[model samples]
Target: MKFKIRKSKILRNLFIAIGLLSLGNLISVYLIFNTAGVEAKVTRLLVKLLNVNLEANLPTYFSSLVLLADAILLALIAYGNRAIGGRFWHWIGLSLIFVFISLDEMIQIHEQLRAPMEALFNTSGLLYFAWFIPYMAIVVILGIAYFKFMMSLPKKILKLFILAGVVFVSGAVGMEMLGGLHAEVHGEDTLTYALMYSFEEFMEMSGGAIFFYALIVYIEMNFEKLRLRFKPKKKKKKIKKIKKNLIEA
Candidate 1:
């Protein structure tokens, strides 16, 4: 027997999930900014990434810039995908795009979150994900646009999202295994650390992926507007021609 999901409940669950995730993330960010102890560490990382040696604070321009660019790129992507078929291959392609971005996000989160922990141990050469926060924000913003606006995704998008998760986790493990062997020989915690990093990244990205999938599904469920925008050549003229041929026949 085939499984069928209800549209209304899916829509409800999706929005609820997005709301909770966004709220939780905002609270965490508020804490990061408000607390002095975490604030300094976060500032130091930001300064280093921006390469600002002067005694000035970080600018809000970073966010505005990312948002501006993300808006453009997202609009382009949505417009570009207006008429894409909702098929297995198409699903795979979309999944890969999300996965590629998702993996990059995982790597970035690992770098960013690991910095503070590394700093706790006084690891001097450690680096932080200063600009990465903004970059990730763009990804999230685009994700929101993808969900809210662009409504064209494969059937069973949830399954495709899960497939991407499996692939990413497998790749992460494989890379770490090779490094882990080396770490064992060198008497280092590199493998363990890498695993910890991957896990952290996975946690952060996994929720975003689900939100992303739900967004795609939402858009797909409303594909008529999406279709009219996409299928320009198959409009009135084509219908007129078909009618003329039928009348003659």
Candidate 2:
């Protein structure tokens, strides 16, 4: 059977998912702060589900989903550019980057890079995070390269896209800086560390949610009838010959 994928439905589901995740994260925080005993077990479980903890499960999965969404957007843009006879391979490049990002999100490539980068840089403060050094540089280069392209986009799309980027970066890099300093002094086991990490997770997911909504809106605006479905063709029934029945009659 064929099923249509409506933007409205997608929007609703995405919003709901983000809301529920946020609520779960908040509950975890509350439990951590206020309760003890069996509640601690429940809180730990919730934290795992909500991406507040260091476990590479919920957060990784959610980040992968976000990267996949970004990759889809880039793919659509690449198609649109090609349709318009535009020669911009940059969109394809961005899509490929998102693919890598999605994989990296799940596997924690940036985390693994931390040690090497720290050893090389021998820095402190925000730069002590190490990964952020190269990451910020890449962001700068990409921002410069895509400045004109971003400016050329429709106002609504441009605004949403930029908002998504700013939100994501604020959490990923900005909060990371703060968290790094805090960890440097207090270690990662403190309540403050958990709180900062919780906030970071929320921001990352929130950014992804916003970007997903924006992409859906843009696609719906451009191609109002877009849908994804799978339908199986019905088999034809074989007809039996009836000549003998007519002769008998």
Candidate 3:
């Protein structure tokens, strides 16, 4: 009914996973570029699955799953905070945001905005992707809206949250802008572009992992224990007897 998780162990595993995924992406890129003659079908499939720059692949799924994990953690924290009469809604909002982000990661909702945004703004260079504009606006709005809530957090949590945000945004927006510019100039088929995007994905994944760790730490600090309980089903005969006794009384 109760489960105890070692936070350090979890953090270590997360870092290991991130490192392996990044290495996989790098190897895939290298193999794709260096391999001459027809590649084996399985090798080609592995390359496609491991490439971090490509969509609908292992890296993308991992990222989405990471975001989903963050959302679940945030939701649990929100429930815990609500029970304690703390900042319940703020945690809920974060959970919701992560939920949307997880879905977006899988479906590439932001990517869908690129072409229309480019057409509407006639943007180029750093804005070649054109998706980060709206995303940046949303970030600004969220920053403003959550300013007070962020300020109210404990210094440790506040610092971790800021660090995670910077890391994630630097990759998701900052590197994206630079990558867009690079793609606009040299095009996407280059090794340089692959490396840039790979780095970007790495940052995003790392940020999510850090944020997940932070949430786990927060829960450990604020709650006595994290656990789950399942209730056993009542016997029908017992229920009927209890009902009859109640009626007689």
Clashes of each: 3, 0, 0
The reply for model 1, stretches above 4 Å from the true place, is: 1-191, 220-249
Give model 2's TM-score versus the native structure. 0.77
Best by lDDT: 3
Residue 243 lDDT in model 2? Answer: 53
Candidate 2 lDDT, 90-154, residue by residue in tens: 78988887887787767777888799899998977766678878888988999999888888878
lDDT of each: 0.42, 0.74, 0.88
lDDT by residue for model 1 (1-249), tens: 112456467446644643453444334344434557755776555433332111121211222222233333334335435445423333334454554553443243444544564446433211222323344465566567556223454456555545544544443443334434445455343434434333433343333444444444544554434423445666978999999999999
Worst 10 residues of 3 by lDDT: 224-233
In model 3, how large is the Cα lDDT of residue 152?
A: 90
Q: Rank the candidates by TM-score, best first.
A: 3, 2, 1
Assess candidate 3 and give its lDDT: 0.88
Candidate 1 weakest ten by summed lDDT:
51-60
**1 against 2, candidate with superior lDDT:** 2
What TM-score against the true fold does each predicted structure earn? Answer: 0.28, 0.77, 0.89
| lDDT, residue 36, model 2 | 61
Clashing pairs in 3: none
